[model samples]
Structure formats: structure tokens, C-alpha cells
Target: MILQRPGRLAITLAIIVSLFLLLPLLAVVPVSFTPKRFLSLPEGEWSLRHYRALVENPAWGAGLWLSIRIGLISAALATTLATLFSLGMWMLRPRFGGVLMGVALLPMVAPPVVSALTLYFFLITLGQANDLVAYDTLAGVALAHTVMIAPFAVVLISVALAQVDRRIDLAARAMGAGVARRIFQVILPNIRFGLVSAFFLTFVLSWEEIAVTLFITSVDAVTLPRLMWMGLRDNIDPAIAAISVLLIVLVTLVAVSRALHAAWRGRKAG
Candidate 1:
């Protein structure tokens, strides 16, 4: 079949857009390899010194670990709450579902400054100001992130749940299968991919979150991005570039793996 020429322009435009989106990341990878301590294009030599420094530095290591811990905890909390909320919305009436979903999405759609200010004030009033439960505490940071990312989780999980075939539930009911048994044995298995995708997305969102974390966390509970922000303020170091490169690589790998898994599952399902 011959394609129309008009569509060719759209394809070309898409390629250009993709390249534009990828340029900064492409530039960063090479810059991470620069031998100079300061930010610059690669000159005479390329070195892995920055990468080495990142791995060997205690502060960076601790910050990275803290970020990972917080991200995992927040993701788990968000995923659980979102899953239940989405399920409730799906099972209930349209008006109820719409209201619940809208409330869930409020945190994500609201202005960052508003969220930061509100949380700061709320925590202070709750007597968490200088205590372990205060702004800089790990629990506070995790809770803030959970609230921030729950909306996204709900949206993703709702999509997954929407894709589920209602007939499966009907059939199970016809056979006298209980709701718990049906959900565990039939529904979850079908939407496994969506759940996995939701988990990864939630995790990544929590991992990359900086705005709320920056305002809510102190030195002891500072996340990797927050630490990087402070480090950049003091100096422009290649170590930051190295950390950025590592993060990019990690996220890319996880995304690719999810895509491959989804593809493989699709084939198997077909």
C-alpha cells in the first residue's frame, strides 16, 4: 500500500521532537565523563573518576540509600492506597468515583508552592516542627511523597482496572466463586502488568521528587536530589554529573525492562 505524503511531515516532526527531548540527556552522559572537576565539554581526556568518586563517597552513598528507602516506602504506601481507592471507585457509582478521583488528583494538579507552604504550616501546627516527625524527618518526607504520588497511582491503577473484563467477574459469580477468591485468582492475574507498571511509576515518581522533599526535609533526611541541589549550590562538580548519569541509566533500564515485560506478557496472553 502506498502511504500519503502528508503523513511523512508528521513522522519527520516526531523524529525532530524526539531528538530535541533527548539532547540534554545525551549531552549529560558525555559531560559526566569529562576529566575536569568543573562543568565543561570533554577536552583532552575522558575519565571515570567522577563515577568512582560517587561510588566511594560516603555522603553520596548515604543520600542515595536514604532516597531509595524513602522512595520504596512511599511507593508501597501510595500503591496500596491507590489500589484500594481505584477499586472502590470502579465498584461504586459514577458520581462517587468521579468525586474520589478528583480528590485523589488534587495534590498532583495543585501548584507546588501551595503544596509546600500548606504542608510546612500543617506540620508546624501538628507539633512536628523540631521533633523526629518534623519537616526533615524521613517519615515526614515519605508521607509527603506518598500524598504527592498517590494520585498518579490511582490513575494508573484505574486504567489497569478499566482494562479488566467484567465478564470474568460475572462468570466467577455465576460459578459461586466468592469475591475474594475471584479477585485473587482471576482479576489480579489479568491486571498484573498494570500493577507492575503502576508500582514502577510510583517508585520513580517518589525517587525523582525534589520540590516537596526540598521544602519538607532537613539535612539528616535530605534525599539524593536535595543533596545534589545543595552540592550544586556550593560548586559545579562532575560528581553530580556522574550521579545524574547513574540515575538516568537506572531509570532507563527499569523502563526498558517494563516495556519488554509488557511486550512479552502481551505475546503470552495472545
Candidate 2:
């Protein structure tokens, strides 16, 4: 048996890259359990004082609540609008559809920092033009998130919509299905996977959003990421480390559970 040198080299390189990316994340696990006030691994003692702080501190809870609320709202808004737009574009198949698609995708390609600054100015102008509440508000933040997240949903759902057979639509039309009925009965059911995927993907994006959130929110609207950023500047408490560890554990469990479920489903299908 001859060993494949290239295959072995590629596997070795992949392992090195994975460890380099993941070792920093693992470091936080030990740092969180330290008895020390700052973020360092304990020599011999371990404590949950950092984790306890999250429960004891009202700010942490508020930040978490705010993040969830904003993430849900923004993600739903982005998914809904993107789904509608993608479906319309697919059905219409306009002559300038390519141009429209390019515009829809601009948010993702544009520089995030530049976009954040531009959005900040737009929010201020919008508030003043309406003679209503001016910038640094939840509404502003949500709007920013919606725009930032919509491009991803549009791209994903469009691919799914394209995969759908066009003959199904013609059959629905011949069967006397109205526009709305055809959409709900035919188009949506076919693309449910893409819709679900878009929602979860956008939700995760909004949950981890910090750049635009930082620019938009001023007071009483601090999201978890923003709070963590503030903590980094103001304090070095292991509570931040504890929070990091919690996030790491949750993500690991979710990924593992998803993989197991997929494998089980594959076995059943087989």
C-alpha cells in the first residue's frame, strides 16, 4: 500500500489551521474558571464568581434581552422583505433583473464601516425630516440591521426560487389558482428550506452585530455585543470570559446536535 503524500500533507495542513483558529477560543474556557478578578487561569483555585456576576448584574440581563429582541425583529424583517423581493424578481424575470439583483447585493459588498457611517447620517436626517425622535434609537438600529442582513436572505432565497421548476407555475395558472393562492400554495412550499435557512442565518448575523449597533444606539438600547465591547474597555473581569465560555459551549452543542440529527435523518432516508 502506497501512502498518498499530497493527501497526507493536505490533512496535516488542515489540522494545523484548525488548531490555530480554535486554540484561542479554548483559552477562554480556562480563563473563565479562574479565581482571579482579571482574566487569567487559576493556579490551583477555581471559582464561579464571574458566571455569578451575570445573574447578579442587571445590565448583563438587559443587554441580553435587548440583543434577542433586536435580533428577532431585524431578522424577521430582513427575511420577509428579501423573500418577497426574490420571489418577485424570479417571477417577473424583468429585462433589468440583473441590475436590480446587483443593487440588492450592494449592502454585502460595500464596506461595513462606510455603510455604518452613511446609515448614521441617514437616520439623523430621517428623524429631523419627520420632526420626530432623532438618531441613536432602536428603530434606527433595526433599520440598519434590516438593510445589512437583507442581502444574505435575498441571495439564498433566490437560489432556492431558481431551483423550482417553472412548469409548476404554468400548471397552477391553468388550474385557476389566483396570484396570491399560487404563491402560497406553490412557490412558498417549494422554497421553505431557503426561507428557514435565511431566517436562521440573518438571526445569527443580527445577534452578533456590533458595528452598526454601536453607531445607532446611544442609551437604554445596549445589545450584548455592545455591552461586551464596553466591558472590554472599562473592565477586565472574568465575567466577560465566563460569557465567552457560555457562548462557546452553546455554539458547540448546537453544531454537534445538528450534525447528529442530520446523520440520523440520512440513515432513516437510506
Which number leads on TM-score?
Answer: 2
Which tens-of-lDDT digit does each residue in 86-109 have in candidate 2? 988988899999999999999999
State the lDDT of candidate 1 residue by residue for 129-217, as single tens digits: 35655677787888888988988888888899899888987899899998788878987788787777788888889988888877787
TM-scores for all candidates: the values are 0.84, 0.91
* lDDT for position 132 in model 2: 36
Candidate-wise lDDT, in order? 0.84, 0.89
- The candidate 2 region of ten consecutive residues with least summed lDDT is 130-139
Residue pairs whose backbone atoms clash in candidate 2: none
RMSD, candidate 2, Å: 3.3
Question: Which parts of model 1 have CA positions greater than 4 angstroms off?
Answer: 1-16, 125-133, 255-270
Q: Which 10 residues in a row give candidate 1 its minimum summed lDDT?
A: 124-133
Superposed Cα deviation of residue 7, candidate 2 (Å): 8.0
